[model samples]
Target: MEAVLPVEVEIPSMRVLAESKLKEAEWVKQCYEQLNFIDEKRLTALCHGQCYQQRMARTFNKKGRPREFSPGDLVLRKVLHIAPDSRGKFAYKYDGPFIIQEVFDGEAIILNDMDGNDDALPVNADALKKYYP
Candidate 1:
């Protein structure tokens, strides 16, 4: 006489399966959070890039600044930004010496007239050259 045995398989319960699914969902949520952080970093970089171009144009292209001066400094201003029609003789001409009043964020320079009057105007640093008397 011979005896036969039936094959049996075991499977996890519903509770165990649900727990696995929860773990997977948590992992997916963590991945989404990381993606959000990356997106914010990219957005910040783009904003800075756009601003840098305008800043460079005002700073490097205008006067080709070598050195900068601070407030209440006596400096010469070479007016190259003046229109050609303004100066009948020349277009890229340097104006008489001026005194610096205040520097605004490396963009604008408030300075007095050639005679050092009280009236001050904000001009680009490139338009005015520092005068060392």
Candidate 2:
């Protein structure tokens, strides 16, 4: 009866236990640092939410609609088809009867396409559209 050793005999070496603890602590520290970094990045708040949506799109485009064009105007060219073999969303937006020719200033314009294509390019009077008839 003098040899009664009844108990869970878990014998972990002191050195091994200490090493394991150190490693675990290091891992935890690294994880914390990583998490902190991620939070900071997010905090940039997606770059101030894209600079507050570009300052609310420059204050709602300053109440838009200032599209001015001259030089033989006959606009109508806003068909930016985002093809997926498009023809959905009620297609036929507008596709030029162009023919501005030149009016660079308040909105730049120099379109031309009634088969009279003379290197047509510069166009931005809000994508043009004022060809009534």
Candidate 3:
């Protein structure tokens, strides 16, 4: 008769298991630290972007002069486009020697034609300059 041999299974030692668990914990801690760093960097970048936008706006605004107009002022309106069919390139850039009939807050003005007829719509002072006739 042949004798049967029993098989033995190998198991990791407790020290090895403990070391692996410690390594996993350390890796998780490092990942959390990296996530925190990324979040802080994003927040800092957002603040910097906002500050840059505000600074640019301030600088641009500094270069612009406010247009002021009062009733009875003579002003010329900027001609954006004349009838396309007439005087294509030779058309004057500004149209009116219109009179300011009424002035409203925030640079809004009502204009009157030379014949003393009020314009149908209010015009922005920015679009009109002192005619200096």
Winner by lDDT:
3
Clashing pairs in 1: 75-131, 76-130, 76-131
lDDT tens per residue, model 1, 14-130: 344354565777656755776778888899999999999899888877885367678877765565456746856645466656667778886788777666675445778766665
Residue pairs clashing in model 2 are: none
TM-scores of all predicted structures: 0.39, 0.27, 0.73
TM-score of 2: 0.27
For model 3, residues 40-101, the per-residue Cα lDDT tens digits are 88999999999999999999999998777878889999886688676878878898899999
Q: How does candidate 3 score on lDDT? A: 0.79
Model 2 alpha-carbon miss at residue 21, Å: 18
Clashing residue pair totals per candidate (backbone < 3 A): 3, 0, 0
Expressed as tens digits, the lDDT of each residue in 65-109 for candidate 2 is 666677776778887656677769877788878777888766877
lDDT of 1 at 77: 59
Give candidate 2's total backbone clashes: 0
